[model samples]
Target: MTARRADRAGRALAQGLALALALAVVSPACAAEADPANDYPTEARADYVFACMAANGQTREALHKCACSQDVLATILPYDKYVEAETVLSMRQGVGLTANVFRNAARFDDVVADLRRAQAEAEIRCF
Candidate 1:
């Protein structure tokens, strides 16, 4: 059951990424909006969608909600800052000195707070 669930998650992730990439490519406005602050790459958006959907569940409705959530996140956060915050979060999961840097930093906390707020807003608006 666990293996089947993992496989399903993987397939859903791939489909979400493909859909996000296709949307980014086909939409000129998305490319045009790739400026200094709001420049979320198609890959980044897709990654966000994949992760969100995985957390929410692998249903079709979850995919749509995750996509909407990412759209809200992209509107709220710049690509560079979002990357920085996400990197801090990812690194904080480890048990080494590097992880300590992420885990003990107020800046990291602030960024995460911002992300959480954005996510909350997204949930309200999308879900």
Candidate 2:
């Protein structure tokens, strides 16, 4: 490799190291914000919904808002147990809401009931 290229790489590394050190020293005040896990009520809720929706493979466009709404619902109900109780697969992207999965309404209702019950439990627990 060219000496100039090596020297430039070394300088970049050094600059990165210096920036890291500076951040460590100057970021305490920023880090002083309450920890979500222990200090904030909504943080854990948001985290839970985000994780659950991600696991269920909700659409990216809906994830943030869906997670937030789920978090609020979870406060009224426990989402964790609900998500745990059923098999949640990814919702098909671009599929209309009226798209039918099963031919039988009874069977589809059963599946929906299972999912809703899970959500209901989560809401109650979150509350």
Candidate 3:
């Protein structure tokens, strides 16, 4: 009877471990489906946070604020558009006649404008 009880306990532990492994595998897929920024890769989010903290000032508070800002941006803008706008902004800031194209392109300006509006909203909502 004691041996049988031990065997049952071992089976219970194995079942529990299997359940945990299943949850660990499935939970992220469920979470990704629920998350709005599912299309934004982890590196993109990290880059945004790093840039935001740099602009806002590096501090503990800045970390939360930057994360909040990125979340707000991700909520408002799709990742593709966000990338396009960031690219425009980066090119516009370049120092050369070649950069003039990015600086002067009306479409790029519009994209950057949209990003600015989103950033402003994020500032109000997050910061």
Candidate 4:
């Protein structure tokens, strides 16, 4: 179970990174001037929230969403890789992911890193 959880966590992190990169590349169809990834900060927040959810055992959907044969933890790592892993799992709206995932020092750091990267991508490509 530990191994499986670690594998799942690794997968979730990769998907989050991929999602970040993809979101960065693909501008929204509706807006030409506005950056899709930063239009509302939802993606960054969602990234953190979903990761928190996965870590806290709130949901396992991210396991399915982030399926990969190879371990992808390093490729998708932020400071709070574990918390981000948890956050990326449960992701829901009208609730909170930052609050759920930010119970640790490392987790909070990872959120900041992830948010910064996402924000940068939004500015460089989307904007």
Q: Report the Cα RMSD per candidate.
A: 14.6, 12.4, 2.6, 20.3
What do the candidate models score in CA lDDT, each in turn?
Answer: 0.85, 0.54, 0.90, 0.48
Position 122, candidate 1: lDDT: 90
Native-to-model Cα distance after best TM-score fit, residue 11 in candidate 4, in Å: 0.3
Query: Please, what are the lDDT tens digits per residue for candidate 2 over residues 98-125?
Result: 4344323465556556657646665455
Model 4, which residues run further than 4 Å from truth? Answer: 28-30, 33-127
Off by over 4 Å in 1: 1-38
CA error at residue 33 for candidate 4, angstroms: 6.3
- Stretches off by above 4 angstroms in model 3 are 93-98
- What shift in Å separates residue 70 of candidate 4 from its native position after superposition? 47
Give candidate 4's whole-model lDDT: 0.48
Q: Tell me the tens digit of each residue's lDDT in model 1 across 17-86.
A: 9999988787866555664434777788888888888899999999999998888877887777788888
lDDT of 1: 0.85
What local lDDT score does residue 38 receive in model 1, on the 0 to 100 scale? 45
TM-score of 4: 0.23
Question: How many backbone clashes does every candidate have?
Answer: 0, 17, 0, 17
Worst 10 residues of 1 by lDDT: 29-38
Could you tell me how far off, in angstroms, the CA of residue 17 lies in candidate 3 after the best superposition? Answer: 2.5
On residues 1-127, what C-alpha lDDT tens digit does candidate 3 reach at each position?
6999999999999999999999999988888789866777889999989999999899989999999988888889999999999888888788899799999879888999899999999999988
Tens digits of per-residue lDDT, candidate 4, 8-127, equal 999999999999988877755444345322233335445644654565446455443332201123223433443454455334222565655454457456565675564344334322
Best by lDDT: 3
What local lDDT score does residue 94 receive in model 3, on the 0 to 100 scale? 89
